[model samples]
Target: MRATVIRAPHDIRVEEVADAVVREPADAVVRVLRACICGSDLWAYRGESARQPGQRIGHEFLGVVEGTGADVTGFAPGDLVVAPFVWSDGTCEYCAEGLQTSCPRGGFWGSAGSDGGQGEAVRVPFADGTLVKLPADAASDDRLLTGLLALSDVLGTGHHAAVGAGVAPGSTVAVVGDGAVGLCGVLAARRLGADRIIALGRHTARTDIARLFGATDVVAARGEEAVAAVREMTGGHGAQAVIEAVGTEQSMRTAVGIARDGGAIGYVGVPHGSGTGLDLSVMFDRNIALRGGVAPVRAYIPELLPDVLDGTIDPSPVFDLAVPLGGVPGGYKAMDERTALKVLVTP
Candidate 1:
């Protein structure tokens, strides 16, 4: 089998690796059908996130069950399923509370000694808990499969941002960033019934998708200028709910600046750099609430899967580029160069 491996900064390759197989009673081997690159993966690609010379990469995928260990009963061969970026034991207290990311035995894919999603197949641990069964018909529908693939990460993360920010009927929401997750945040705010969605981004193509996803307004500015635009649009009140999907000091500050007094900010962008630029004094004085972190996407899958299947929300548009397993290096380059929003990998 061949899988993507990070040789160094700006060096991603598809190399032959050991085959995936069930290694534990709670394990399952899945032949990947659809996989995609994540924005977070760029950290390693850019050398911002450390990785060994040959570490596996990628973390979103859906596939058909090739085999399952004896103790795994929730899935069987030929079942279509999606695996969350992180695997968790469904029985953990954290999982029961819908925080599978904190499960005691949970682990992320592509970590050392683990198989990555950007491969032909993967050996999944805690199979029943980590894999969500998809409708058999989804396997034959490319569009539906792409939408289902978003549930493995971005869609669920965006939904988490909405839920964390308390988006509700008629609420005014602002989404920071215009990347795939940010665009998905716009869709999520719409799904939650937000009447006004303000998307902050500079990219024309991405903002166009934001509009299609229900962004009532697009602020193409950045820094305090963007904050002023959002505030003015809201009559100096700012948005009631803000989804901070870009993990950066400036973006975080923009989220805080554009949130109405007593409003909430749901931040799901994987924090990078030295400081978060969070000011406790301002939040305290304004009674603003801060929520969200690494999204527990595994928990949100069940809630959002129905909408994807029914075509109520289509996240597939975020996948602007498609690549075969052999073209993964170019896929990474395209994303790194900002030429692609998201890359769909067909193995």
Candidate 2:
């Protein structure tokens, strides 16, 4: 089997590796049909996040079950499935509360000795709890494939931002950033019934998709200018909820500044930069509620899967570029260079 390995910053290679196989009774092996590079993956790609030489990378994928351990049930060979970026045991207390990302027995893909997602296959732990079965016909269509693949991570993360920010019917929401996750946030805010969606971004391509996904306004401004634009749209009151998708200091400040006093700010971007960390004094003074972390994607996957299958929400536009498995390095470069919003890989 071939898999992506991050040897160092700006160095991603697809090379032959040992095949993924089930090693525990609760595990299953999935033959990946589609995989993708996540914005979070760029942290290591840029060397901002530490990486070991030859470390397996990536964590968004959907595939067909090739084999399962004895203890795994409700899934079998040939079943089409999607695995959340994090693997969790459904029986845990945190999982019971719809917070699978915090499950004590859970861990992320490409870490803790698990196979990475951007590979031909993966050994999925907590098989019954982590893999969501899809209709066998689901993978046959290009649009559906893109949507389902989004469900594996980005869409679910965006949904988390909307939910975390307390988006509700007739609410005014602003999404910070125009990355795949940001665009997906626009879609999620609409699906959740937000009356007005403001997308803060500069890229025409991404902003275009944001509009298609349901952004009522696109503010191609940054910093205080962006903040003023959002407040102006809300009659000097800012949005009721703000989704911070970029995870940078400037983006976070923009999200906070554009959120109405006492409103919630849902952020899911992998935090980076020196000033990106939380500032308690600011939140305390404004009575702002900050909610979000690594998204509990498994919890939302089932909630959002029906919408994808029913044609109610299409997030496929995020994958603007596609490449073969061996061409993953180009995919990384495309994303890093801002030439592609997101890249999809096929085995």
Quick one: best TM-score, which candidate?
1
Tens-digit per-residue lDDT, 211-235, candidate 2: 9999999999999999888888899
lDDT of 1 by residue, 1-347 (tens): 99999999999999999999999999999999999999999999999999999989999999999999999999999999999989999998999999999999999899989999999999999998899999999899999999999999999999999999999999999999899999999999999999999999899999999999999999999999999999999999999999999899889999999999999999999999998868889989998898998889999999999999999999999999999999999999999999999999999
For model 2, state the Cα shift of residue 24 in Å: 0.7
Backbone collision count in every prediction? Answer: 0, 0
| Each model's lDDT | 0.95, 0.92
Estimate the lDDT of model 2.
Answer: 0.92
Q: Which stretches of candidate 2 lie over 4 Å from their true place?
A: 277-279
